[model samples]
Target chain A: MGIGSDMYRQQILDHYKNPRNYGELEDADIEHVGENPMCGDTIKMFVRLDDDEETIEYVSFVGDGCAISQASASMLSNELQGRSLEAVRGMDRDDIIDMLGVELSPMRIKCAVLAEKVAQDGIKIHDGELDVEETTTE
Target chain B: MSQQAETLDVERIREEFPILEREFDGTQLVYLDNAATTQTPEPVVETITDYYRNYNANVHRGIHQLSQEASIAYEEAHDRVAEFIGADGREEVIFTKNTTESMNLVAYAWGLNELGPGDEVVLTEMEHHASLVTWQQIAKRTGAECKYIPITDEGRLDMEAAKELVTDDTEMVSVVHVSNTLGTINPVSELADIAHDHDAYITVDAAQSVPNRPVDVTEIDADFLAFSGHKMAGPTGIGVLYGKQHILEEMEPYLYGGDMILKVTFEDSKWNELPWKYEAGTPIICQGIALAAACDYLDDIGMERIERHEAELAAYAYERLTEEDDVEVYGPPADDRGGLVAFNLEGVHAHDLSSILNDSAVAIRAGDHCTQPLHDVLGTAASARASFYIYNTKDEIDRLVEAVHDARQLFA
Candidate 1:
């Protein structure tokens, strides 16, 4: 009556349980914190970029959140580690959603993608390139 | 206890709520989110419909027959609500948008005047954001200190901590009668006594308690009590703030507008009497009438019986859910608790669990439940909550158990 056992694949649990690269990066050039007050999920993304902002020197995350959010942060931190700041900032919602390796409902999508969005926002804010107005959820 | 429980016809009472008749997917609509808001009954809906169709008019100002009828109906609803909570008089019941607004009214009007630099407003760590944030803003405005009575790991409020925090300098003690997240009902009557002894006022956020249990403002000895109509099977956008008459007379009007003014002068306007002074502009007439109908519905069912029924249901839910190998339930597993269970599955995140449950057409709240501080204390960012009301039944609980087992299998 439900999805197959592959839905709870061991790899997913492993990533969720012992999330990779889950901590703050010291001497980071950019930092952003996003919070879901509805679920009390807090994610902090730290990015340390090299001079000229062409390469990502380091990236790490520290957050108190659900397993999906933590795992998403872990995956995001790993994916952005060697990528350029421009590449990281250019990542869209679908790129991060696909990285999660599981389907997310509309409501849970925000929780899964919050870390990636925060990273992009942090980079934009730090690079003095933030031009868009903040979006308010009803 | 068994004989007393037998007096209430559970099945008959469940028939009153129309939502119980509907089916969700293949299963019956097992609404366990009553603490969030109860399902409105036919009578309450009819009351609103009747008002809008027949006698919908601006209240307190009209001399026409329909307008007078509407005005009377609105005031009568106030009287009904006032009596339901054992308030001193209908004049003490001020209508606001919801419990949040009611709390803000007290915070802005009363607390702003009484609370100042070096003064303290004591609150519990278990309060919802509505109660906690209002006082926090008040503290920020007055340079007053906001102290908290911490809860133990078991979700019980520490009286020793409360005693230490509530002192001569404490001007107000605002606490939730029942925690919406944990479902732990506090001993507010005793707390009110303690607050009064210290010459401090007590305000209770009865948003969770009023619907499930019988609340008497006089018995609790509360200076002010606030609850939302939506939570009690009434329409939304309407709430009641029950203040002691003398205390209400002392506070300034919350908003300046028509119906709240007694004598209008450009320089200064005198405010109207007790409840009307606080109710600025046009009231939620239909919502208030619906709220009165809701009050009548609950009263007819008897609150004590409803409380016992929910306690039994909660106990059943706790025992059944905890029987699973990997589930962790929050709050005390006692008859004293309200009919709410906040829990987590070992391998599944709460949002995932809720989504799966939604797929099965089961409606349960999956989030912080609006008590972030309490969630922090529980050591979880989110939890799946199943809260019960009059419409819920043991069969629904059984279905929930089956669905939960099925949900875990998805994670497995």
Candidate 2:
């Protein structure tokens, strides 16, 4: 990799190339789709809750987007396993940026955090706090 | 190289734009985003500074010396744009915020009133959202049906489809003169003939065409034309809309306020004359003046020379990019395109490509380029665009190619 191009570190490229948990959960109790209208990066997140209905049993996503966005989804999916819905909902922009380990511009921040948004919105939709046709990370 | 390209002194032209000398670290800035906006030259910047320093007054407002100077220069800017586009002086030119507003001015003032339930508005699949959305909303409001002219496999406007679509029911035919995403130089003049044959008025979105080449509204028989100033080396927040005098006079004003009013009562008002009637409140006086300087700068170099320079650069970039492995360049063959090239690198997203290229100080645009439907047609979510201008060189494109090569390897 070229110097000064740390944004595409090997870790990010690895996750982007072989995304972990990169598929849909057919039995997902909570599913939501989000899109970054700026770059047309879309992520549809699927989360299945355990019998307690609080802990995430499994999480996966399927969509087309840039490396930052898709890798973000992959990394976030791995992190979301066994986490409670409350924990996923509590996740914010800083957590995603911290996980990426890169200084993201405001535009890239939207791409980096799109998966988190979809997961949170899916929880919100399940709880009946928000109503919308589709969630978007504007 | 073509004769016109040979006549252009690119080195001398590069001197006018000090921004070209900018460096990211030790690497010199290779600006390939001219399709988004061009770098402002010293002349246009000086004009803007001079207006603010010496004649910072509202035009057509005060009788003072500064106001008079501002008014005259601002009015002359309209005439300059008129001459630039081969239109009649001042009478047909109206300054709006940008090309989007200029298009809305037409869609609202003409389309809203002229179009009805059965009327059709024929646009192309390659239209920028500025034209497509404005007309789409207008069609929704007016109950007019919007039809699209499809594109050919070569990424050019299907003239046959356009001819078939623009029937007697078509009231307005608006298309971009150059596809900003594909760099396809559409056959607008022929499309104008078709629109006219069916008694439909045609509008040309010259946002891409006006900056890169010699575009004559008269030669194309365009009833209306729109272009932004910033895309041509002027300041932002200023754009030009040129319409036929008769049509402009017959239509009601799109906006209404102080400057656009000749007389106003509590319940009634008489709108101002042709151009002023459309310019509502206090206008972009300084920007309008500076845009004239941009026109002057382009004229001094001769637009034909600039066009040839960009054409050659685009063709070269296309050739070089196609030489790269798994690089899919969009648009027609280089001979039939404008100054831009949009492409995709296999297994690399456009945004990722843009970021990687940025590390090498090679700037390019990455996104849908405001042509989402067009991207759908291209079957890609987004593409990277490298656009050229008068100051860009083959050497810069070489740097871009080398950077892309590095990016591909890095991704691999």
Candidate 3:
């Protein structure tokens, strides 16, 4: 049986149908792209750093995937709009699924967290803390 | 219902497969992913169990009783596979790990030796990555150019394009006998004829064809054919690569080990006969024996009956899928295709539809079906496929239709 009807709540459906902060970003401080090759879900996250360079000034995402991936990216974009770069690294798969108010199957875990991966990757690249080879994957 | 039961006997056939009796989430499992791999029958399972329990010995190595028994059984497996597909003889069949390995065995052993720079290798866009990627690697290694035969919008092979593609420079023309993604049954016999006209050898990836339909290597006139055992009510890790005896005799051995060598020393070694030269090491002994049992099981049921049953189910699924306004079906009409229906619902991703379908205990395959080129051609990222088998019933189709409605309600 399915996990629960709670997974497909109207709010989650709303985010998927009318995604928030959707589209590419120009003059972005950090841009990261990620994909779950298994299902061909491609997600890109762009973060514009505020003048202080500690907090996220604006966040935008672009992706083509299942509802869970798209909705998670949409909902997460709103959460990261003004958060610090520190909070982005602290976020994991559970936090994303928890925010969605649903449980994701193991096979779909990659989809729900692809946006968060891109955001954190963007943070690492922005700080110049990540190796170029490492940033190329995950 | 009772009248139609006489023709299919699905209930009786279901009993042969123990997995069909299983339940998921308090509901009977409706397995619609037969095209990926068919569930093994009790007889095939028992045959494998008997092999290990009774005669568990490495074939062609020992002169002991267990070795003799294992060798006999394994040889019988080759004989059964040969007869199953109307191969010239037992020597034509070579056991490999799976269909992928079978395809690679030809690419490495045959294609690498024959194809070179300035040569063209013709393939269909509808090939699974197993068949397509190997040719790509061959092209890279041999400096051969790989060309594709275009598929029509409706998923049928465009013969006109194929005529242009398979020119005199083409040395090998490889194609899938049946497309795993779009369910289109290709005209391989005619393709083989075209390849022969160009003086090129043809290889048929029959992994999707031999299971549900009657396939004869002789009738198709294929120089090489490959199919997996798991897809035909047998075990995994057991596959067959059938080549014309003369072609196999001339090709270099793909692997080197004890069983494949007639005489080995520090200086040099001579290879064994036609089939054994390709099968290195101990090989999949038990799975091969069970594969013979699977062939026997299919023979008892009759390939013609299975083909008819699958065609009917495919037609029904197509009819039901087309009735929904939001569903855009893929592949040719049921009469022209095999026993599978692939489609996409409006605003529903294939994975999402499959996740929801699982709630109803209906199993299906979602995603590109390993034909990324075909998926790109179809303008769909992924599609949901429901493939039928001998054990599938109309009741399962009804449940699948209901599951689609539920998916549409949730997503669309």
Q: Which candidate has the highest lDDT of all?
A: 2
Model 2: per-residue lDDT, tens digit, B1-412? Answer: 6765557898898999999998887888999999899999999999999999899998999999999999999999998989999998798999999999999999999998998999999999999999999999999999999999999989998888888899999999999999999999988899999999999999999999999899999999999999999999989999999999999999999987889999999999998987999999999999999999999999998898888889899999999999987999999997778999999999889999999999999999999999999999999989999999989999999999999998899889
Off by over 4 Å in 1: A1-37, A40-64, A70-87, A94-103, A125-138, B1-7
In model 2, the runs with Cα more than 4 Å from the true position are A1-4, A132-138, B1-6
- Per-model TM-score versus the true fold: 0.89, 0.97, 0.96
CA lDDT scores, all candidates in order: 0.83, 0.91, 0.88
Q: Per-residue lDDT for B1-412 in model 3, tens only?
A: 3546336677888889888878877888899999899999999989988888899998887899999999999988899899999997789999998999999999999889998999999999899999899999999999999999998888889999999999999999999998888889999999999999999999999998999889999999999999999999999899999999999998999988878888888999999986889988888889998999999999888888888899899999999999999999998986777899999998888888888888888999998888887888888778899999999998899999999999888876
Q: Which ten-residue region of model 3 chain A has the weakest summed lDDT?
A: A129-138
Candidates 1 and 2 compared by TM-score, better number: 2
Give the chain B TM-score for each candidate. 0.97, 0.98, 0.98
- Order of quality (lDDT): 2, 3, 1
On the 0 to 100 scale, the lDDT of residue A15 in model 3 is 94
What's the CA error at residue B405 for candidate 1, in Å? Answer: 2.2
DockQ scores of the candidates: 0.30, 0.56, 0.51
| Candidate 1 local lDDT, residue B44 | 88
